[model samples]
Target: MPLPEDAPELSPALDPWEGLEPSGGQGSGGGRPSKPGPGLHLVATPIGNARDITLRALDVLAAADLIVCEDTRVTSRLMQIHGLHRPLMPYHDHNAAKVRPEILARLAQGAVIALVSDAGTPLVSDPGYRLVVDAVAAGIKVTTLPGASSVLAALTLAALPTDRFLFAGFLPPKSAARRETLGELAPVRATLVFLESAQRLADMLADAAAVLGPRPAAVARELTKLFEEVRRETLDSLAAHYAAAGPPKGEVVVVIGPPTEAAGASEAEIDAALQAELAHAGPSAAAAKVAAAFNLPRRQVYARAMALKAAAP
Candidate 1:
């Protein structure tokens, strides 16, 4: 993605920290008084590449009274790259409860505080929900500086249906719980987006295949960085590939196409599958297997399975 010809050229001469008074605050020596007024600014950081961040985000970060982030080390590296030296504070799942009140107090005092995650947008499977809620309740101004997100990036590369979609975040680590979660999402009419761990990628895909049938999906890794990869295929095929190749390195995002009429098993096909499974397994077991294989509702499959058994001569 290149900048437009009409777009302003970004150079060292174009300072990102132009309009702001010198800071007399905590964390760092170069604390700058924010010009954006008192508010909670939710900034979106780049997911992978260092340069993917927006110009507006940089400005807000530079002008913020204090920068609250998931990890100071991670945020520090980003700040260093763009020649920014703002006061950085740690605020994540473990420390949000303790630090949120202090942040709110600052916001109340007309301090422009910028909240950001390690990457991407805040509150999208990231922290900062409670802070936003508290800020709003306290009548403090809240705003967003949206930029790069792995969810949208993967969807773009997936070539899947995008008109309607859901970002379900990460699934359960265990197989049983994960399958149950996938079963719940099996009937969704829109495409699905998920962030997954590298080690659990294979297992997650396996459960997804068992519960979602053979929907078309894509596995995207290391997005926007060198060695970025997107493997698009059926859910079952992806499961098999990961099972064989093991998990790849870096962050992962999985995009699955929505359910389709063509993907649904026919009544005859269901009956045949049920009959075959019932020959060796009990009704409950047979239904579970068939329903999972077809991505159909278990109760629906079980009812038909019982009918077939009763009608058997």
Candidate 2:
């Protein structure tokens, strides 16, 4: 999708660490200050390309006494790219509970600590929510250095409605639960953004089509990197496409259009629609048709049809 001509040109010069105060005990006095005040710095890293990091993020990484990250190796590579050599520690779902206190102690000691994830912004479908929750409860100075985010990047790439969107972050693993989740979100008026593995894209799309009807959607993958691709189609069409071709490679973001405005229906009108559908399709199919047509509950329509069936003859 072509960005608007007026859209701010996103460039590599956007780095925040270009020229700033030296960090990590570099002072005019040549001696470390007693303690850098306590705070938690939320840093954002590149989703794919290495050069997408910000200069301010580099400054924070260099200045902080210690850095906590989802993957030490991943963050290490990022820091190495920026020529930053700070003490990096692993803080993730597996050990977050055990490491939270240690991080708190550092903050309590007035040490500036930086938190980052393997990719993109922290706490975005990634770990670090609990840490932030705990830090806020402790009244610690928590600040964020925003930069690249996969969600924003995908939204831009998908060419979908960005003014209003809901990041659903990964659907349930099981089909039933996934369908229920889709059903629950079917009425949302905002464009729905979902993070899904390549393998499950087809099934998710199918479930979304069944629950939300044939809405327009886009499947974006390999974002910000070489071989990036965005496939746009109606939900049902996309489902069939993927179902036949199988899933594609790389991470995927499924962006779905919002629900269409439903036309008002009278009970008599619904009954008539149901009666017509029932003649050929069974109760379930009839209910599904009426539900899709009027955007109403299948069960409710089914019950009403049953009552009508009971009253007939």
RMSD of each: 14.5, 13.5
Best-fitting candidate, scored by lDDT: 1
Give a tens-digit lDDT track for model 1, residues 272-303. 89999999999999989987988866655665
Q: How close to the true structure is residue 18 of candidate 2, measured as C-alpha lDDT?
A: 67
Q: Best-fitting candidate, measured by TM-score?
A: 1
Clashing pairs counted in every model? 1, 6
Q: What's the lDDT for residue 307 in model 1?
A: 60
Per-residue lDDT value at 297 in model 2: 52
lDDT to native, each model: 0.86, 0.81
Could you give candidate 2's per-residue lDDT for residues 105-213 as a string of tens digits? 8887788999999898999987799999998898899999899988888876664456678999999988999999998998887789999998998999999988887
